[model samples]
Target: MTLPTLTIGNKNYSSWSMRPWLALRWADIRFEEQIIPLGPRGLGPNPDILAVSPTGTVPVLELASGERIWDSVSICEWAHEQAPEAKLWPEVSIARALARSAVAEMHSGFSALRKALPMNIKRVKRDHSISAETQVQIDRFDALLQSLITRFGGGQASWIFGHPTIVDAFFAPIATRVRTYNVKVSAPVEAWCQTVFSDSAFRAWEAAARKETWIITETDEA
Candidate 1:
C-alpha cells in the first residue's frame, strides 16, 4: 500500500515539522518526506504543496489517496486514524481530551517561545539565556509538565501520557529549545528532554537537519 508523503521545513528551526514527524516515526508509519528549506520569509516554492495547503506551510501531509492534511495537529490526527493501535493519544477519554488539548495548545500557542528561542538543535553554544517572553513560555511549559506528571506520568514511563504519545511529540521541540536556550527547568523536564533527544528517530531527524544545505537568514549561525 502507498503511504502518505510529509512535507516539512528545515528541522533545525521548524518547530511545526517536529510534531507530526515524531508521531509518524513513533507510529512506525512509512512515509516519504519532502524538506523544503524555510527561508527568512518562512516559506518556499512547491506549487503542489501550496495548492494543497494554501498557506504553503511546511509539515503538510499528502496522502496516497490524494487527501491533504495540513497543520501539524491535523497531521497527527490523520496519523492516529491511520494507526489507531499506535495509541498516539491516551486511552482514557478524559486523558485523551487533555492530551488533545495540550497538543492543540502547543500548536496554537507559545508565540513567545517561538519568537525568542527558535529550535536550533545543531547549534551548541556555551551560554543559552532565554528572554522574558521565553521565560514566560518556559514557566507555562513547567506547569504543563507538572500537571502531566501528576496525572499520567510516573512508573517506568518517561513522557506525559505514561507512554510516548503525540503529547510527547508536541513538546519535542521544547526539548530542543530548553537545550539550545539553556532554559532553567526542573529535573522532571530535564530528564524528559534527555528521553526525547535519545530517541533514535529524533536523532536521525536532527542529523539530517544539521546536514541541510539551505540556511534561513533569520537562523544564521551564531
Candidate 2:
C-alpha cells in the first residue's frame, strides 16, 4: 500500500500537528511526512500548506487515493478506522464513549491555557505564570487524568485508557505545554504527563524539534 502523506509543522511548537503525528507513529502506521517550516514570517496559512489543505493548516493527512483530511481529530478517526488493531479507541463501548468526549473537550475547552502556554519544545519556563482561569483549566485537566487513571488504569500502564489511544494523542500537546511552562498538577497527572512525554514517538519528535532551524522567537523566550 502506498503510504499516506502527513504534512506537519515545527515539532518544536506545533502542538496541534503533534496529535495525529504521534497517533500515526505510535500505531506503527507507515506514512510519509512533510514538515513545513513555521516562524515569524512563515506562520500559516502558508501558501504551500494552503495549496494542499483546504483549511490552510498543518497536520493534513493525504491518502494514497488523494483524499485529504485537515483536522487533527478527523485524521485520527480515519487512522483508527484503517487500523482497528492499533487499538486507537478503547474496546469497551462506555470507555470509548468517554474517551471520545474527553478528547473533544481537549480540542475545544482550553483556550486560556493554550494562549498562556504556547507549546515550545526548546524552552522550559520554570517560573511561568498561570493566570487564575488557566489554572482552573489545568486543574480540570489533572482531575480528568486522575479520574481515568483511578477508573481504568492497571498495572504499569501509563496511558489514560490503560493503553495508548486517540485520547493520548489529543492530550499529548498539553503534556508538552505543562513541561514547557512549569504548570503544576497533581502527582497522578504529572505521572501520566511523563508517560506521554516519554513516548517513543514524542521523544522522536522532540529530538527532531531540537534540530529544526525554524525559530518562533517569542515562544523561545517563554
Candidate 3:
C-alpha cells in the first residue's frame, strides 16, 4: 500500500497542521507530508487547498485507501486506531477521559488566546500583554495542565501522560505560542511545553519553517 499523505500548511504559521503531523509521527505511522503555503487568514480562499480538501483546509490526511480525514483531532484519533501501541491516550480510563477533555478544550476552546497569540516559531516578543479575556484562557489552561501534570506527568515526564500521546500533539503548538508571546504559565506546563519544543520532530519542523520563504504577514502581525 502507498503511504498516506498529510497535506499541511507552512510550518511556522500553521498550528492546526502541526497537531496531527506530530500525532502521526508519534504513532510511528509512515506517511508523506506536503507543505502548502497559506495566504492571510481573511484574504480569500486558496484554490490549491480547495482542490485537495473538501473543507478547504490544510492538514488533510489522505489514506492509502483513498479516504481523506480532515480536522486535526479526527486525524489523531484515526492514527491512534491504526497504531494501538502508541497508546494515543492514557491506558487508565479516568486518566484517558481527562486527557480527552483537555485535548477537546484545546481543540474547541481558547479562542481568545488563539486569536491574541498565533504560533510563530521564528518570532519572539518580550512582555507581550494579552487581553484579560486571553489571560483568563491562559489561566484556565495552566490549571488544567497543572492537574494533568500532577496526576500523570509526576512533575518530570517529558510528556504529559508520562509518555508521548495525542494530547501532547494537541497542545504542542501552544508550547510555541506561550514562548512566542512570553506568556506566563505554571512550571510543569512550561516544562512540558519546553519538552515539546525540544523534540527532534519539532526542531525539524522549526528548521523547515525558518527556511520557508512564504510570507504570511497576518500571522506575524501580532
Candidate 4:
C-alpha cells in the first residue's frame, strides 16, 4: 500500500511547508515528500503545485486514501488525530488551549516579520536590520514565547509546555528565522530556539535544506 505524501516547496524557503512537515515527523507518522520547486522569487503560478493543491500552495498533505489537507495547521491537526499518543498538543487543558492559541496566532499574525525576515535555513545575515514594523512583531513574538516558556516550560524541557508539541512545530521555522537573521531573544526563548535547532528531525530537514540548489532570489536577497 502507498503511504501518504506531503507536497512541499523548497525546504530552505518554505516556512508553511516546514510546519506540517515537522509535525508529521515529530508525531512519528511515516509519509513521503514530493518537492515542487517554486517559481522565481517563490511566487508561483507553478502548474505542479496547482495540480495537487487547491489553493496553489505548498504543504498540501495527500492521505493514502486520496483525501487532501491543504492548510498547514489543518495538516498538523490531522497528524495529531492520527497519533494522539504523540502528544502533539499539550495534555493539560489550559496548556492545550494556549498552545492552540499560539498556533492560531502564528497562522494569521506576524505579517511584517514574515515578510521582512523570511526563513532561509541555508543563509545567515547577522547584520540584517529590523524595520520598525518588523520590530513590533518581533517584540510581540519574543514576549509571547517568553511568557509561554516561563508559564508552561516546567523548568526542564526547552520546549514550551515541557515537551515538543504542535506549538513548537509551528514555530520551528520562526526559530530558524531568528537564527538566520540573528534576532536577539530572551534567554529562555533563545534556549527554545536552540532546542528546535538541535532536534534530530529538524537537523535532518536542515541538512536537506542546505543541500537544495533552488534559490528564490527575493528571499535570498532579503
Name the top lDDT candidate: 4
lDDT of 3 by residue, 1-222 (tens): 699999999898999999898888888999999988987556667888988899999889999889999788899999989998889888999999999999999989999999899888889899788899999999998898878888888878468989888888888888898888988998898889889978887788889988988877877777
Better of 3 and 4 by lDDT: 4
- C-alpha lDDT of all candidate models, in order: 0.82, 0.86, 0.88, 0.91
* Sort order, lDDT high to low: 4, 3, 2, 1
Model with the higher lDDT, candidate 1 or 2: 2
Per-model TM-score, in order, reads 0.91, 0.94, 0.96, 0.96
- Better model by TM-score, 2 or 4? 4
What does the lDDT come to for candidate 1?
A: 0.82
Q: Write candidate 2's Cα lDDT for 166-201 as tens digits.
A: 998998888888888878787777888889877888
> Which candidate gets the maximum TM-score versus the true structure?
4
Q: Which stretches of candidate 3 lie over 4 Å from their true place?
A: 41-44
| Pairs with steric clashes in candidate 2 | none
